[model samples]
Target: MQHLDDATRTELEAAAFRRLLHHLDEHKEVQNIDLMILADFCRNCLSKWLVAAADERGADLDYDAAREYVYGMPYAEWKAKYQQDATPEQTAAFEARQAEKREQKDA
Candidate 1:
């Protein structure tokens, strides 16, 4: 890996995060379940991470507020607008993936 200065790395990371958020916003058809099934994380996970990081810094950010920051609107509005019910195959795949992760962790 290239040795990046701290400031440069932080700026790049922030830019990448903004790009990811924009990409997700543009691809509203990609449901959260699909993200979870494929990546083992979703927008909600990002929200939680944001809240946790804030808490670590002695900030009092809540999940709902962090989710709004992540989703670019209230999570309920985003969900109602974009989220779809997962198909049986999607759910099964997600479950199998989770089980595999758990087994890997245990091993």
Candidate 2:
């Protein structure tokens, strides 16, 4: 990547991001709690990132718009169609991850 020209690198990055969205779109069964437990991020985090990126670039984007883009539909629609209630195990794992993150931050 360091050897790649900036424009080419950016293009590759964009391609990868698109592929990620497609992958997530395909994996609708993967719940947000699962993602949070494993990676500390979920679709909603991506939406927030999109909004922050837009703000940084002076592009007009709000949370709802970013969420729609990320979810490939309105978030409420996605939640109704696919989101699931977190199992007790998932909830425990997510809580543990949160505690670890806080410990690291404080350390």
Q: Best candidate per lDDT, number?
A: 2
lDDT of 1 by residue, 35-73 (tens): 988998999999999899999999999999989988999
Give the Å error, residue 93, model 2: 0.6
Residue-level lDDT tens digits of model 2 in 1-107: 99999999999999998898999999999998888888889999999999999999999999999999889999999999999888889888999999999999999
RMSD of 1: 1.3
Clashing pairs counted in every model = 0, 0
| lDDT of candidates 1 onward, in order | 0.91, 0.93
Q: TM-score each candidate.
A: 0.92, 0.95
Query: Model 2: which ten-residue window has the lowest total lDDT?
Result: 31-40
Backbone clashes, candidate 1: 0
Specify the highest-TM-score model's number: 2
